[model samples]
Target: MATPYIRMNGAGNDFVVVNALETAFRPTQEQARTLGNKATGPGFDQIIGIEPSDGADAFMRVWNSDGGMVETCGNALRCVGWLLLQSTGRDAVTIDTLGGLTTARRAGPDQVTVDMGRPRLRWDEIPLAEEMQTYGIELQVGPIDDPVVHTPGAVSMGNPHVVFFTDRLDDGFVRGTGSLIEHHPLFPEGVNVGFAHVLAPDRIRLRVWERGAGLTKACGTGACAALVAATRRGLTGRRATVEVDGGELQIDWDQATDHVLMTGPVETEGTGTLSL
Candidate 1:
């Protein structure tokens, strides 16, 4: 029999979701690669599995386009949240992931909000090769006189990220400099690289180079990282709309709770069965 699955997208970051809780479904690296093949399979940025959880409504297993299982995905979280809300008919849903426990709920018309929890600010938390300033860490690429990219802010939103405050999004910096810094020695664990251009106090234009997935249409965690980094640098206020390649997300870094709240939309393209 074919395996059953649902296809969803948060903004433009798409995913293939499966109900592991009901079917004990698990995709191998080869299987994931096959499914993400755009021309042939059900191409998506990542594959998410919904499994029974001990501490939350469900456990979200995340696999990057490369089929490597990672931790936490904000956009995917919202998609899963909507699923749980529909199935259980609840106002809210808590999801447990390798990164941590997160909760999501309905925000507005066809939109969802997720609490990403406080960020890990220490260099050790980002797990850089050694200790350094999280703000403007001592790392750079290109020539000494004029580096292609330099002085990025670092933070860990479950996983890890390095954000470069650029003047514009339509530049070579995103694709040109992203790959170099993604695997840079500074970040012990690979990282998502973000290029952000603050349009105003309440808005930011951004792009990201995901660690394992390369350039994606949208990156939820990357948006959180950019907002946190912008706040730390006093670029934008605690709340703002982060515009990504795919769409925009409302980000709120609450001072009282010290948690990042991300609100966005999820689109279900529908479901189907695949022989895996």
Candidate 2:
């Protein structure tokens, strides 16, 4: 059958979304690899599926471009929230994900906000290979005499991430150093590597190499991870504007609730039906 699909992007992180709440539609990893390929595929960072949820408005299921199923994608949550809001005429909606339940609301005509939940800081939670300090684990790149980047702050925003604060944004540092650390031995489940340059206490220029998605224009969870990590290290405040390759996202780590809030925009690039 021809299943309807919505093509959406938050900032520049794109997705191919399908609704399976009323139908029995399961996405295979093979399809993800095909749909996420830029040269010969549909070209998306991830594939999102909306399914029936007993706990929330919908359950968000995602598969990375490398055909790996993952727990969270924050931008996708905002996109789904907006879709439900548009359909139900409600400003707020709760979404169930592999990560957990996330509450989202309309912030503006083109902007949406999602509470990403508190970050997981424990080594066991981030699922590091061994017990160590997550803030600065025993990991490094380059020569021992002078490493390119080291002592990153680790945190899990439903997914593992290691954030490196650099003095400047270098293409070599972001790509080269990020790639090596993604598969480092310290992270048992692998990790997303982030390169961030602090423009101010409330502003950062960031880039991420996702666990299975590779390099993306923007990663919502990655942005949240960056903010929480930076704040924990006293580098930034609880709130900041993260400028990714795609665009900017306003992030805040609420002190009272300890939940991270992400605000951004989602665009409907186009709509079509997919043959499955």
Candidate 3:
């Protein structure tokens, strides 16, 4: 049978969303890969399954284009939240995922704000191969004496991420450096790589090479991780605007609660049905 699906994007990180609340459905890894194929199926950075939840408005199952099931995706959650808000006519909604539970609220006509829980800073949390200070890990690229990029901050916003703060945002630099560090021995689980340039105390220009999904236009968790990493290094304030290839996002790491809040816009591309 053909299952209905909705195509949505949050700040250019697009997804194919399946509402399984009424009729439960979960795609296998192969099926996910097929749907993510641009030439063959509905191309997307990730695929989200919105299933009924006992504890929250919905349970989100996320799969990357590579067919890997991941803990969470901030942009996918925001898109799902918007769908729930529109359907329930509520101002806010709660979502459950393998990573954790998060709450999303209406921020504007096409915008949603998600409260991504506290970041995990411990080596065991980011699950590095060994114990080390997450604030800055001793990893480098290029020559030993004059490395191109080094001393990146590591953290987990439900998923492992490492951010390299550098002046280099060139396409070749980001891709070359990001691809090398993504599967480095330090991160036990493959990590999402971020290349960021601090424009000011409250603004950053960022790019991300996502694990399982390479070089996305926008990555919600990557933006959150960037802000957190920058704040930890005393480079940026607790709150800032992150400019990604796709668009802009507002990220705030609450001092009191330690939760990161991401606000961004979501757009519906269209709707379609897919054979599962």
Best by TM-score: 3
lDDT of 1: 0.89
For candidate 2, write residues 144-189 as lDDT tens digits.
Answer: 9898777888999888999888864667667777778888888878
Off by over 4 Å in 2: none
For every model shown, what is its TM-score relative to the native structure? Answer: 0.96, 0.96, 0.98
C-alpha RMSD values across all candidates: 1.3, 1.3, 1.0
Candidate 3: which stretches are off by over 4 Å? none
Model 1 steric clash pairs: none
Q: Weakest 10 consecutive residues, lDDT, candidate 1?
A: 167-176
- lDDT for 23 (candidate 1): 77
* Cα-based lDDT at residue 13, candidate 3: 97
lDDT, residue 28, model 2: 81
Q: Which residue runs of candidate 1 sit more than 4 Å off their true CA positions?
A: none
Q: What total of clashing residue pairs does each candidate reach?
A: 0, 0, 0
Q: Return the TM-score for candidate 3, rounded to 2 decimals.
A: 0.98
